[model samples]
Target: MTNVLVCIKRVPETSGQILLSQDGQSIDARHVGYTLSAHDECAVEQAIQIARSTDGEATVLTVGNDDSLEQIRNALAVGCTAAVLVEADTENFGPADVAAAIADAVRSRETDATTYDLILVGNDAADTGDFQVGVRLAYALGRPVLTGIGTVEVQDGTVVARGKGPEGTEVFELSLPAVIAVQEGGVEPRYPSIPGRMKAKRTPVDMVTASVSPVGNGRAALRLPPSQPSVVEVLGEGPAAATAVVDLLYKLGVAT
Candidate 1:
């Protein structure tokens, strides 16, 4: 059985206009809603799919504040066996701190006899596009790592991963106890059912304190480029525009 650990992040959903903080240091989430990162949702789904086939169990882990419990419960509602929360001030932590915290959590789990055969994480967090967690965790654990993975499965004790390459699909094979950074567009994440949600609500999350001090890479501020407005063109009018319409269609390859 392949026991898997999937890491997720609680991020502000970009369903509406994005608002930045006055200093451009972060997203202005005062009016926005929070949810699991899209890529991490796919990672959770893939972990469940793999574990279900082998009668194994999948655990979801997150490093955030108390509010992150909602995201952890959401993963449990889908199919994860349990959840772990590394309680911390998520806003104050940078990518390096997050990675250190996760690494510490993994080590703690190992001491408790909860060994994971595979580790899965989103290619990058949704809120901040810091893509270093998986790689850093792999290094901390002294395991092989792969990123931008679109598909993953186990066969004969080997983990096979696939993703889009410059020419076509690229594949990689690794032994058990490996790390993978899962990308979006890998699979459709299943929604939580009524019964599943009920069960998840009852599940107790294991909350732990960080064993390491959070360190930053000296980040200054974030800036976004101004958006370009759309332009509309009027192509003549009425019957007089018939010739223009035909020409437009021809130019668009709708007709020869």
Candidate 2:
């Protein structure tokens, strides 16, 4: 059976205005909600699909503190058969640090005879936009890796990945035991059902302590872009605006 491991990160939901912390080292998430990135959710869905089709197991993993349990349970509710948490304070953990922690966890699992045929991760982090984790993780494990993949499938002993290239869709094939960084839009992530949620609540998460030292991303501060200015011009009010509308459409070359 093909055992798949999907790596995810807990990121602040950006549905509202994002505030930075006083130290400017991270986002101010005290008042905001948290969720997985779109790419990570898609990767989890893909892993579940692959595992289900192969009669295998899909395990979800994350490097974060206890608060990340919610996100892990969400993945379990969808279809991941197992879950792992690398207990660590991710606030100051850069891409290299995160990658090292995950690699350690994977090696620990291997020691116990639990080997993953494929490891999936998001193409880039939603909060930091760090696109180096998957590549770094692959390097640490001595495995081939592909990034920006939208679709992936396993056949025989090969994994096929497809993504958008400069010209058109590009496809690559790698042997088993590889890493793939997934992008969104390849598959629709399924929502958790009531029963699934209940079942997930009972599933115990396996925890591992991160052994690597945190070398924070060399960022002095975080800055938000200036808001764009908006200007509105009222055209007309009621039926009296018919003439103005026709003229505007004609000037835009949409009228015959």
Candidate 3:
């Protein structure tokens, strides 16, 4: 049975307005909610599907502080059999630092004979938008890596990954023990059922200390794009508006 590992990240929920800190160094999440990246949600689902079909176990992992355990439990509620938490504050760490820590954890687990046959990661982080972790981790582990994959299936000791291209769907075949960076293809993530949630709440998560120190590059502060201005015009009032609407439609060639 193939063992699968899926990496998850806790980022500020992107469904609402995003606010930056005054220093512009990071996202101001004081009033915002937190959730896993959309692509990572697909990754988790993919891993679970693969493992379930093969009678294997699925492990969900994250590089963050104790608060990130919420995400781990969520993964468990869906289908992950277990979880690993690389305890640290990801707020101040960059992609390289996070990748190094994850690689360390993978090595540690392998040393204990908990080898993973497949690793899944999000194509990019929700908040930082960094896409280096999966590639870097694959490099560190000396494994084949694929990024921006939409669909994935394991068959006869090989993985078939598919992604959309400008022309059509592109497919790649790779052997076992490969790292794949997942994107939101056509796969829909599943929600936790009542029994699943209860089981997840009682599952124990393995927590470990950070093995790598965060190092700084020549990078500066983060910034957000300027908001677009909205324009509104008064057409008319009551029956008078019908004439204005008809004239506008005729001018736009929507009417003969």
Candidate 4:
């Protein structure tokens, strides 16, 4: 049977409101309450789908503190059979560090002859919109990786996946044991049933202290919110009235 591994992260709630630090470099997670990103939830669900259809074991892993354990338990509640945590003290770690930590855990499992046929992750963590960990992890593991997958399925000995970029959709058929990064809307994640939740609470999460490298290359500072538009100025009242609006848009380089 194939063993599938899914990677997930607990991130802030979905919002366009970017809380900046005093410096202009990164976000402020000070007041943020981490939750499972919607996109990643889909990734987890997709892994479950693959496992159910292919008759394999699906496991979810995350890197962070005990809060990450909470997130992994939720994934288990949905469908995953087990959870792994590379416990970190804080969320300040970068993708390189997270990747390294995860690589360590993966290598350890492999050393024990624990088998895994595939590994999966989200295209990007929603909170930071940083699409790096999955790719980096794949590179570290020296495995082929596919990113931005929209649809996925396993047929025979190969896994088929579809992805869309600026150009269009691209289909890929990958051999087993590949890494895949999935996007949202691919599959609706299921909520945990009461029995699943109970079982998840009982399942022991394999926790390992992460040897994550420190991050602070350049300190970031926060800034205040930009001024909001005070009032609306009516422009085009009708199609005939849009001539001037179109002219203004042309001047602003939005229209030719």
Which is the leading candidate under TM-score?
A: 2
- Give a tens-digit lDDT track for model 3, residues 24-125: 787877787799999999999999999999999999999988889889999999999999999887667878888888999999999998889999999998
lDDT, ranked from best to worst: 2, 3, 1, 4
Which regions in candidate 1 have their CA more than 4 angstroms from the true location? 227-256
Cα lDDT for residue 107, candidate 4: 87
Tens-place lDDT per residue, model 1, 83-138, is 99998877668888888899899898889988888999999988788899999999
Residue pairs in collision within model 1: none
Candidate that beats the other on lDDT, 1 or 2, i.e. the better one? 2
TM-score of 4: 0.81
Clashes of each: 0, 0, 0, 6
lDDT of each: 0.90, 0.94, 0.90, 0.81
> Positional deviation of 206 in candidate 3, in angstroms?
0.4
Ordered from best to worst TM-score, the candidate numbers read 2, 3, 1, 4
Candidate 1 global TM-score: 0.88
Where is the poorest 10-residue window by lDDT in model 3? 210-219
Worst 10 residues of 2 by lDDT: 226-235
